[model samples]
Target: MEFKNGKITKGFAFLDTYELTVLMKAKKTSKAMKNTMEETQGYLGMWVTEDGYIRHELLPNNRYDEDRGKRESAYQGRYKVTGNHIEYIDDTGFTADGDFVDEKTLHHGGYIFHKKLE
Candidate 1:
């Protein structure tokens, strides 16, 4: 923020040309971040059960089985999502990655997860 003669001239607004200089500069960075979403219900529950229920669980936090519910071992890993790319880090420090093939399809671990009912 800045103070000028009888005006509340601030960081976002510039009195030099009465322009929003700061917001314009940050727009590019904001646009990049906007392309990524975190833990949306659709993405969080990608896996479906045999009974046609979407397993709304967080990845990297638990090892879950469609038949056996959640177990104490396997596939517990943290994940990072940016744009269409996903990175995974498991409990054993193993790292993997995948990309979104489409809005309803994810290509991960050599498997194609589809949003279709199975």
Candidate 2:
């Protein structure tokens, strides 16, 4: 960096290929984080199977709680939704994913879910 008259004259740093790639990846990750935060709001609520067996709740803080049968909190995890695709990482290290068929419908693990009405 060079400075003249108390102002920056040359302030750019040239990066190597690996450094540039890392920087780009960091930028992309930041953008994806922002998008996930925004998109999660629209998906925050309870989604359930028709028989009410599986109850999945997407909380405001990007964490989820799922109840199966009579088991409350059968699964608890953090989740990220990119576009209409959702990925889950359970507290016990189990992983799963799902897709939104529409605004109110989700399909995961060979089961279909609908947004539960309040």
Candidate 3:
């Protein structure tokens, strides 16, 4: 019985060590993701269609405000950009995504938006 108890204790220790290692790895991965997002800041700015009907403002805080057909802030959302691809989760729970075709162009929801020059 004493031998069995010793094995159980060793097993618990192994599990604890494994959990700690996993947590450390997770923290490292999170930092890497944050850095990647920060590097994407160059893409931040206003993007609008040629006709000036739809506008999307990509803010530095990782949130977006969209205007449509003179409607101010038609939609508001949080966004994540990964390697020229973007995912959005709006305040109303609607989700959408887009791709950056280039430094000045974004293609989303069948609409092509150009970066509005300041």
Best by lDDT: 2
- Give the alpha carbon lDDT tens digit for every residue of 26-117 in model 3: 99999765554236565699999999999999998989999999799999999999877899999999999988877788999889999998
User: What's model 3's TM-score?
Assistant: 0.66
Kindly report the root-mean-square deviation of model 1 from the true structure over all alpha carbons.
Answer: 9.4
Residue 65 in model 1: shift from native, Å? Answer: 8.3
Candidate 2 Cα lDDT to native: 0.87
- Order candidates by TM-score, high to low: 3, 2, 1
Whole-model lDDT per candidate? 0.55, 0.87, 0.85
Best candidate, TM-score = 3
Off by over 4 Å in 2: 1-40
Q: CA lDDT of 4 in candidate 1?
A: 98
lDDT of 2 at 55: 98
Q: Kindly indicate the candidate among 2 and 3 with the higher TM-score.
A: 3
